[model samples]
Target chain A: MLELTKEPFFGFSLCMFSYIIGIKINQKTKSALANPMIIAAIIIIAVLAVFKIPLENFMIGADFVAMFLAPATAALAVSMYRQFDVIKKNWLPIVVGCVVGAVSAVVSIVVLCKFLNMPQDITASLVPKSITTAIASKLSEQLGGIVPITLAAVLVTGIFGAISSPYLIKLFKIDNPIASGLAIGASCHALGTSKAIEIGEIEGTLSGIAVGLCGLVTVFIAIFL
Target chain B: MKLFKKTLILFVVCFISDIIAYFLPFPFPGSVLAMIITFLLLLSGLVKVRQIEPVSDFLVKNMAFVFLPSTVSIVSYLDVFQSILWQFLLICIVTTFITFVCTAYSVKLTVYLINKRKEKTENA
Candidate 1:
């Protein structure tokens, strides 16, 4: 009777162990399909369910880790700061790409939701789904959306971005490093940037820049419009 | 010690952004606001990149792990949230591709035009 659920180490160790395993599996496979976040989430949930641990118990220590999301997001500035030269050269394309990317994501979601006769609450949640989960979840709350639904949508969107971005670039024969990275980050956020970083330095820098730019664009769009 | 200072700087910036967003009618996500504010500060040379380097690297590199608590939240919403699962999932997948395509094409177009303008100037 360890009462593992009551102890803080239980949740913290569970997540760390799962994520570390996730990274290793991803490296061995050399595929984005086995995303570490998805893998870790599934493993953690299974462990909790198998032991019948209440979510409240798991969230205690896990909550401290989650608080990093905000500062981590703001850290996009560090990436931008590092790549000031690239950003300075391609400012217009970056801005335009992110704005267009945000608009297209929101518009297409609205159109599809309405076409499918989806409910308004669900639509509100889905509207900002293209943004990073941290910002999207907050936007979802502000728009009277189901926060979890929005988080789920944002994750799925990111997964699509990560798995499909390389394919998308190849299918379209996109050669411009700036354009490719910008597009991936604009659409995919951090998940896509991981792939971009694999491709080259230019794409990595631009993609990192795109994550923050698109987040800002989507937030303003979600809040004001 | 240095990491603490960097975190404090970012924390202060994030707090100010949160306050600004709170006063607005539209509830903007404060962290994103902080991101923009920080970006500007960096751009203006107000905050040197070296100042936040250590903390930012740790935060960004391990960003995926930070999402653990939120992703685990899926368990709580399994009942009410998944009612429209098919539609929501369908829309998410389709729009993601569409947005990706549009973003890439738009960036391509802008770069193309910029290159064309450069070519024309060189010719002149």
Candidate 2:
């Protein structure tokens, strides 16, 4: 069984199978909390913990899926490129909105970490939490953060964004989809975009567009910090 | 066929961007550099959006899958995370709300001003 897991196909298949199960559960529950990714992660973690599977073996099968992150992120340009017209008309607001979101996330995390006396490495790991995993993971490596913690932070942030965005929008009395979408994408990344998509197409498009922008903005801002 | 080709294009673009970032002074992540380069290419009409739409859509739609391994791998760090879990959770939740509200309000205010400026111009 250990050798089987070490095989390249094993991890990939495990993730795919888990995702399918997650999807089925989500479909049946029809609950936002039943997110497929979270469910899949929960299931995979449970299995790995139960078997005490070597992290190395699991990674052998899993790294291939992780590789998709780079190209997929680069591909974000295509979707946002389609939104070029909307971007053109509201470039000022859009740019400012993304900047605001990125700055707020990074700054708050740093400040909170300091206030709590969190260790430096952990603080660094949390820096890119609000960005998508593709970029956040890379940034964490550069910033010398623990990749796992950074990944956890990014996932938790995404899930929280997806779950809470609607209520936040309502409480803030934000009526415009553009406003809501910009906020969601900036704060939540892809997960947030998924929720935005459920609410409206324009919101979805704007939210998706914000993911790359927030990533880029966070990257540059992180450089300065 | 089309999706495969588009995906190849994105891959090639990313590969080239990585090479470029490797040689640059203070390289931002290659993925981000690739995204910017790709955006520029699309803007100049060098590459049509339709050409990459299929692959882009696939990758973005299934993004959560690619991230699954990393998220699940967190179990390995259980000892480290166990103590700080509540604080991490609190920060994640609070900051998300802060960023969300700040962004929405900023966009709303900015757009409102832009519209107001347009109205003034029209009236004049």
Candidate 3:
């Protein structure tokens, strides 16, 4: 049984199987906290521990799936293109909102990191927390940060954003759909967009567009960092 | 055949972006560079949306699954994370809240200012 771990198929099958289970739980619960990635991560980790499987052995096949991340990131262009009309009409607000959001996210993280005396790698990992996971993970790698920590930070930030955005909107008295959606995407990425969709169609569309815009703006700011 | 062909185009774009990034002085992300190039290609009509639509849509939809293994691998770094768990949460929660508020208000303010300017021009 332990020997099976050596085959790439073992890890590949494990990841796929766990993800399906995770998706089922997500659907059954219909709760934001039941995120498929989070559930899958917990299940896989538990299985690996129980089986005494080494992380590297599982990584053999896992790396194959990770390879798709690049093309997937590229695929985002298609979605952005899909939103070309909305982007054109509200170009000024979308661009400005994302820029401000990205700047604030980075600046606040830096300031807190400095105040907390956090290590450089952790700080770097936390810096891209607000961007989508694919971009955040890659940016974290570019900055010499720990990729896993960055992934964790991104997930937590997303869940928080999804759960809190509705209340945040009300608290801030944000009446505009575009503004609410842009804020959610900037602060939370896809997870918040899911909630934004529930708010209204216009908000959902704007949120979706904001994810791409905020990602691009964050990457641009990372150059200066 | 169609999905394969679309995936090939995206991969080719990614491959070219990697080379471009390798030569740049800054540590630009190859993935992001690929994204920009793809977006530009789409905008310029060099690549039609349909040609890559199916594969791109599939990739986007299943993105979380692709990252699952890495997210699970977080267990390996548990010790590092353990020490900074509170700190990590603090930063994420505080920064995320601040980012949302700032972005929301700025967008509202910009839209308001734009509308006000338009109204003034209409009055004139």
Candidates' C-alpha lDDT: 0.84, 0.88, 0.92
- Quick one: best DockQ, which candidate? 3
In angstroms, how far off is A217's CA in candidate 3?
1.2
State the lDDT of candidate 2 residue by residue for A1-225, as single tens digits: 577789988888889999999999999998877988889998988888899788788889899989888888787787778789988987898899999999999998999999988998998899999998889988988887888899888878888899888899899999988999999999999889989999898789889878888989999987776
Q: Model 3: residues >4 Å from true position, as ranges? A: none
Error of 3 at A165 (Å): 0.7
What would the per-residue lDDT of candidate 1 be over residues B1-124, giving only the tens digit for each residue? 8878999988888889889978977677788778778888988989988888788888888877888878888888887666887888899899988888889899999999998999999999
**Stretches of candidate 1 above 4 Å error?**
A1-10, A24-30, B80-82
lDDT of 1 by residue, A36-150 (tens): 8888999999988898888888888798788777788788777767777877888989988999998998899999999999888889989988876667777787788887688
Per-residue lDDT tens digits of candidate 2, residues B4-122? 78889899998998999899778478988888988999999998888888788888778778888888878778899997988889888888888999999999999899989999999
* Alpha carbon deviation, residue A38, candidate 3 (Å): 1.8
Which portions of model 2 show Cα errors greater than 4 Å? B1-4
lDDT of 3 by residue, B1-124 (tens): 8878988999999999999999999888899999999999999999999999989998999999889878988887989988998999999999999999999999999999999999999999
What TM-score does each model's chain B reach against the true chain B?
0.85, 0.85, 0.96
Report the poorest 10 consecutive residues by lDDT, candidate 2 chain A: A73-82
